[model samples]
Structure formats: C-alpha cells, structure tokens
Target chain A: MKEGKISLEEVKHIAKLARLRLSENEEELMTHQLNNILLYMEKLNELDTSNIEPMHHAVEQVNVMRDDKLKPSLSSEKALSNAPQQNGVFFVVPKVL
Target chain B: MTEEITQWSIIETRRRLAKKEINAIELVETYLKRINSLNPSLNAFITVCEELALKEARYYVDHPDKLVEKPLGGVPIAIKDCLCTEGIRTTCGSKILESFVPPYNATVVEKLLQAGAIIIGKTNMDEFAMGSSTEHSYFGPARNPWDTSRVPGGSSGGSAVAVAACLCPGAIGTDTGGSIRQPAAFCGIVGMKPTYGRVSRYGLIAFASSLDQAGPMARNVQDTALLLQVISGYDPKDTTSILKEVPPYCEEMKKPVRNLRLGIPKEYFAKGIDSSIEEAIRQALRVYENLGARIVDISLPHTEYGVAAYYIIAPAEASSNLARYDGVKYGFRAEIPSPDLIHMYLETRSRGFGSEVKRRIMLGTYALSSGYYDAYYHKASQVRNLIRKDFEEAFLTCDAIIAPVTPVAPFLIGEKLDDPLSMYLSDVYTLPASLAGIPGVSVPCGFSPEGLPIGMQILGNYFQEDLLLRLAYIFEQETGLSPKYPSI
Candidate 1:
C-alpha cells in the first residue's frame, strides 16, 4: 500500500474497464483527485492491524430471508413503461461492434 | 386538530387511531394535503402513491381489529425510490427506471407493509444513490425544506425532507456512505443506519452491495427505533443479509441512560471540519456529559483515510452492481439500429445514468478491472479492514462514539455540485460507520447562524443499536429538540 502517484493513464484505464467514455477534462480532474486519495490512504498503511484478524461482519449474522411464496406481481405493461426503448418483452438497444 | 394529525409522532398517530380520535383515512388526507401543498417546492417525492395510500388507510379503518398485529399500525411513511415497492414506480431517480414499476416489494417494504405502515410515496434520491447532493437525480434535486436555496443532503434527500416537512411521520432511507445520515443531518431529523447486515437489502437497488444499508429516518429517535424494529431481521433472499435475533427496539427506549461511556474521535474534529459543526458536536457532547455519561477522548487514526478508501471501494463495487442495468434487462434501453448488444449497453447506460454516477461507475470499474484490482480495490478492502479495526478498538474503550455527521451544515443547491472532490468530503465523517458496518444515528444537535440544521452522529458497537437508541433518546430529551419540525 505505498502512496504512489496515480497518473492520468491510470484514470483512463480505469474508465475503460468501467466502460465509461470520459472526456479529457474528466480524466485530468480524476487523476488529480484519485492521486490525492491514494496519498491519504497511504497514511492508513501506517496503522498496525497485523495482530487483528480482519473483521467483515460488524455483528455475527446468518441467513436473512423470506418465505418462498409467489406474491402479487406488477403487470408487464407497468414494468416496461420506464424503459427508454422497448420492443414487446425485450428492451431495444443500439448496435455494438 | 387538522394539522395535529399530520404532525403527530408515530406513537401519537397510533394512539389517536386506537382512541378513534382520527380515522386512518383522515390521517392520510392531512398528510396528502401537506404533501400536495409543500412537495411542489421541495420535490421530495418522485412517485406519490396517493390512491394506494388512501386505499390502505381506508382498509385499516374498516378492519381496526387487525391493528393488534401491525406494530406500525396506520402510520404513513415514505420509502426511498431505491427500495422496490411492488407495483409502484421504483425508479432510483434515473430516467432508466423512470417508468419502471417493480414486480415485488423489497423485503423491508414488505415488512413495513405488514407492520401496518401506510405507503405514502417513494421519495427522490441521487440517481442510483451515487451523489451527496440529489442534483444528479433525473427527476430534479430535492430542495431543503428548511431553506429552498440549500439542498437537503442526499441521496436520501427526498425521504429526509419529507419527514422534516411533516409530510410523513417517518421514512426509510438507504445509506451508502452517508446518504441517510447526511440528509437527516441537513434536514434536522432523526436517521439511523443500522449495522450493515442489521437490515435486509432484498429489494434495495445496489449502489455498493457491501456498503449499502437501509434504515429508518424519522422526526425523533423513538420512531426510528420503532421503524427499525419492524424492518430489521434476517432475509435469505439477500445473501449479505444478516440473520440475527430481532430486538425490541422500542423496549430499549424505556431504558435509562446512566453511567454510559461516550467516545469522541479526535481525528474527526481535525482540520477541514467546519467551525459551526464542530461547535454543535461539542455542545452535544456537553449534553451527554451533563447526563452523567463519561466522555472520553479516543483516536480513530485511520479515519483520515475514509473518503479515499470509500471512493475506491464504493465505485469498484458500484461499477459491478450497476452493470446489470444494461439494455437487455428491465431498465433504460438504448436504440442501437444495428442490433449490437455492447453498443446498446453503452448507448443506454450513457443516456440513462447521470455524469456523477457515470464518473463513479467508471472509477469503480477501473478499480475492479484486471491489473488494477490488487492495487486499488483489494488494497482499499484491506484498508477497510483496518478502518473496521479502529472502531473495534475504540468501542473497547467506550460505549459509543459521538461526532458531527458532516463537516458543515447544508450548503446551497449548486454549492459543491460541480466539485466532486468537495462533495466526496461531505461523507468524510460518516463513511467510516458504513465501511465498518457499525450503527450510527444522526440527531438534530443545533442550528447554524443562518438557521440551517446541524446534526451530531452517534456511533455504536455492532448490534449495539439498543445502546445507540437509548443514548440518542436521552440526549434528545435533554436538549428538548426532538420534535422541532423544520418550518416549511
């Protein structure tokens, strides 16, 4: 967890993985912000948590669930009303390479 | 008496229903009227379930005997749009789901319905619960009920505002980072984010699954306890949902606060915090001290890394969680004349989600992407473990931790909307609680000079919500500030 500098290339790469088409301005801004964030996280590296086992659950908890029962469902029309583009049961979309 | 019904607390509302002072229909009407009058300016609700709420209220009137089983019995409340309410428009404030009505109620919503709580409406939120301000919502930003020019700190902005404006006695808000607490703080209401797994996330649209939690937002501590009592418990549908024995949250209210230990994390009050907020927290600590609770100085050294660690971890998870919203599924579908799935996804997502959400999604996607996973996302999780440990150690020293919910009071509508970094900092004080999966309650502590609400957060140990509620109830009583509703 070294406090190494995060470059614009890293931001661009992250965006690509995220499938985001970021403009040049956003990439430049994010690089500056993300780097500062990393520098701050570097301070956390100084903390001694070696002896403490990593604790994920704040309180011990087990399977939380509901009875498997069919409940009243919404109409297909209502369900798809929010779709920006739809064709019957499927949502319509643009072409990909 | 007309306004009395609308302004009553959960207890009073129930009491009136029992005494037949006002029927459920009248109760719903008063609130509907208030919402009708005030919601135009506040923009607190995206989908107002007026007809359904009225229908439910009328049913309660005809079947009063059923009230015995319903703990929330006839109390009207709002649900954050992110939580799917069966047959209701459960838009997470994005155009992608703008017309989408969920086929099922989120587990919490079902629980609320069973408890006799009337579904008033779905409140607005930052689109996909991504921003500190609800400005990113496609519907429009929720205005602070106290001051229209200022924002009701969001993504639960609408829910908090609805409760604050007396449109609903209480509301449910999902917290990812500080969505619930920040808006609750800004709106000057009582809001609690129970231990991460304390409540089920079955129907809650994911922001960051690990960090997301749903909790009650109310006008006072006891109502929050009441709401929590109903909505909390184990749900198998949500894999991350914790199965734990449900405690009588309301029963804890009767417990007296004496000889309680409160911890003040010094790092939270460090440089960059606003003076007024610091003063408000100090004043609240004084109230706790006056109540005979021992206030001790404790250090959560890793607190400084909160905003940074949260950015990496939240986005990384968000990028993945949000990927399902592609055109093929239920949400916004982009028009790809050439019939390419990838192009459809890109076009739909690009057109559906807002800029800030897109930014975080991109950042998260990047962090979780190959080659960068270890350096960014994995490293952040490790740091998260350390952050959790910091609270564990602090709890060993004190019963609870008290701090300001946000660095400053609510800012103007457009104040930091453009500055993502500053907006990210808004959750600096509150993120640690979510990261560590601890319970935190934000109660109105004081008001700023310009008359904005300031809230102080109470952080408690895991499954220590009883202690958290008891302590908050005591402080709320001592301050005589529990029932002060914001002037609309």
Candidate 2:
C-alpha cells in the first residue's frame, strides 16, 4: 500500500489479474505510466477527509427497483448473434477442466 | 437544395419537411451525399446506414400524417458508435466489438426512432470512450474539420465533426468526463452532458457507469435542446434513470438570462490555459455581464483534485464493467489452441483491447486490489464528495457556473498521443462537473487565432439542463456566429 514507484513485476501481476497478456514493451511502458499517474494521484492524500463519506453514486438514488414481471427477452438466436463462436444456443469457449 | 438542407437545424428541417419545402428522402439524400464526400477524409462515421436511413425517410415521405405527429420527423442525425443501434454495428471505436451488432437499440436510440429521427450512421469515438483524442480508436482518428492536421477532440470526436462539417444535423454523444463537451468545443458545435441520471444509460457500452450520461450535440444551442427533448426521459430499464418529467427545453430558450447569477470559477482560469482561450472566455464573461447577468468570481476549492479523483473512480468502475468482455459470451475471442481457459481469457483481452484500455484496466485493478483498496479507491471517493460539495456550495451563490471547457485549444492530431498524463489533463476543467453529476453545455464562444474554435462551458445544478440551454442560447444568438464548414 506504499505510495512509491510501481515495478514492472507489479504491472505484470496486475495485468494478469485483469486477464490481460501484455507484451514486454507494454509491460515496461505501463510500469512508467502507472507510476506517474499514481504519483499525481497521491495529491489526494493531502486533504483530511475523516468526516466526509465516500460517494458511491453521484446522485442520491437508492434501491431503484422495478416490478418483477416475466417479460419477453432476446431470443436465443439474437442473444448469441455477437458470440465469437456459438452453437445456436451455447457460447463455445476453451475447455474448463 | 442540398446546401440549404445541410445547413438546416432540427427545427428548421422539421418545418421544411412539414411544409413540403423538402421531402424526407431528399433530406436524407442531402446528408448521405455530404457524408460520402467528406467521411473519407474526416473519418467521422464508421458505419453509414445509407440504405436504412433512406428506407426510414421514405416511410416518412409516404406517410406525411405520421411525419407530422413526430417531433424529429425526417431529421437525419448521427449517433456516437458507443450507443447501441439494433442490428447495426456499435463498435465503441475498438476492434474487440468491430463485428458485433446489437440485437436491441439503446434506450436513446429507441427514443430517437420513436420521435422519427433517421439514424444516419454510427459515428467514431475513442476505443470504449477512454482517450481524449480519437487516435485511440481501432479505426483511425477522426480529423478536425477545421484543420485536417488537427484532431476533432474525442472520444466523441466523430459525432462532433459530423455536426461541425454538416454531415448530420445533430448527433448523440455520451460524456464520462468531457467526451461530448470537449469534442464539441474543438469542432465548434454545441454539446451537452445532462445531469448523470437525466438520461438513461441502458445500451451505452459502459466506460464509467456513474459518470456516463448521453446527451445531444448539434450546430446550435436550439438544435441541441430539441434533440435533448426527444431523448430525455425515464426508462424503467435503466435503474439510474431519473423519473423526472422531460421539460420543453426548446420552449425554455425564450426566457432571457437577465438576472441569472453566473459563477466564474477562478481556478479554471489559472495557469496552463492557452492565452487565446483565456482571452476568449473572459470576453464571453463580459458579454454576459453586458446582457445584465452578474458574473461572480468563486472558487471550487477541490477543483485541483478532480482529474486525480476521476482517474481513480472511473477506472475502478470500468475494471468491473469491462470484466464482462472476457471473450466468453460475446465480442472478440482469441483463436488459441489450448485447453486452458485462463490463457484464452488473457490472449483474447490482450489482443482485443487497445493500449489505453489496457492501461486503465491495470490501473484500476491495482487500485481495487486487496490491500490498496482503502488507499487509492476509498481516498479518491472521499475526495470526489468534496469536489461535489464545492459545486453544491457554489450553486447556493450562483444559478450556474461558467468556465472554459478545456484548458487548452485543440492540439495537433498526434501532439499528446504519447503523453498519457498530459492527455488526461485536458479534461481538468470538465471533469469536476461530471463528478458532481451536473448538467454542462459547451457553447461555441469564439475562435482561437489559429482559427480552431474555442468553447465556454456553462454548468448548472443537477437537472438544470433547461437553464444551461437558455444561457447557451442567449450566447449563440448574441454572437450570431455563422457555422464554419470544413472545406474537404
């Protein structure tokens, strides 16, 4: 949690968690750029915000619920229209096990 | 006839269509011809729905009775590619969704169709609305119509240029930080970002969920207001949508800005702003003063922390929202010959997303990671509240706040491409309003000496879009600035 320079190893680890496979050049560039951004963002620590609550939503709208009703939705054909690889009803992906 | 049709506003086009001055098909053809002639150089539209637009316009032409009932009947409007259009490809300016077509229209798109506006095409934008410049687009950057060498500011660059260059009467653009306003300023058109919940975000490919709001961009304030009326309302589908009654925004323009208290945030005029842009905004303040509106100097104390906080909050949300694009259900999937599921996810994402998207995802993941959550994300959110409080307090003193849209003028196409931080800084002034969920409009105020247009942003309290439009309309009428067309 220290506000210091980010290492290439850290960038690679973060990218891995984000499910991104960055190249050697990207890893180096991301390390430098993220560190610069984080350093700039460190300015936020300057303000004393112990009393102020963190805002999750810009507007104060809570529990915006709609009536539960079964309505027509996209058909199987339309749902899988944009799938990279699909077999009419199911999306094809790499073997999990 | 084509020239006249291309220059008409939404209202003017509707009036002409109703009076038989121009048929719907003729109007559609006028814009289609212009798009074909200019889109090659400007790169404004990724997919021009010529046949679809014609088909819709012809329907309106044949059924004049139906055209009369619709507010935006026979009007040709372009949409930013991020907004989903049923059966039309909505790329969000990335190769990841290049071939993906939406099965259902976005809430705004559905509203536009109901209002009789023809969807001309899906315009270009930054890849997932991430970059300030459209250079991050999987498609090439949309060039500034003013100077082909310069960029029409993005990620709604294509939508802005389409309106600026007369490719479309008006276009819909979403603003997370300054995607709509900055681009509209750079292109010398009117763009607005309604209060966050004012417009539904159902089919808008989420960049930053809380910060994103879809609004209208047009050649003038009146047209912008008209288009906003057509698309603004409650949608039960989008939970964040406000259930407020949509006001007659165009009618509200008739009210004068005689005694309106306008606040000029002093921090925005500080250093880093180009001299010419500063001069133009100051001159605009003077014009408001002369028009009987009092301009008070105020300070948004937390203004400096806007960009820093926004970068944290927006990315964190984006990291979560974009996680859905893991090459499982839809979009681009890597053709890897391996039984390992994790490798496919990595390769698919790495190859699909652009550098900016990847950078944000990494930054977000780092911020939201186990130990760093309280440090980065939590701290940033607390600061975000402080920034919003600054606006709320400022509103108690003034009805609206006035400032420059962007600190600097539109730079060359590749000027800030390499420096990501510098590019992020461009949204410094506009980000505060977005963070506060306030409605802000960028009115074409004046042009820089380089002839690139400069815009002044007028911001109002949440759901005060009518006031923002009224103020911008007065400025537009007073200046009587003729629309400058880019000679392709």
Best by lDDT: 2
* Candidate 2 lDDT tens digits, B432-487: 99998899999888898888899999999999999999999998788886366656
Candidate 1's C-alpha runs over 4 A off are A1-14, A22-97
Q: Evaluated with DockQ, which candidate comes out highest? A: 2
How many backbone clashes does every candidate have? 17, 0
Q: Can you tell me which runs of candidate 2 are displaced by over 4 Å?
A: A1-4
User: Tens digits of per-residue lDDT for model 1 on B2-52?
Assistant: 566778889888988888988899899999998999899999999899999
Tell how far residue A22 is off in model 1, in angstroms: 4.4
Overall lDDT per candidate, in order of appearance: 0.84, 0.91
Interface DockQ of each model: 0.36, 0.85
TM-score of each: 0.91, 0.98
Going through the candidates in order, the fraction of native interface contacts each one reproduces equals 0.45, 0.91
lDDT of 2 at B482: 39
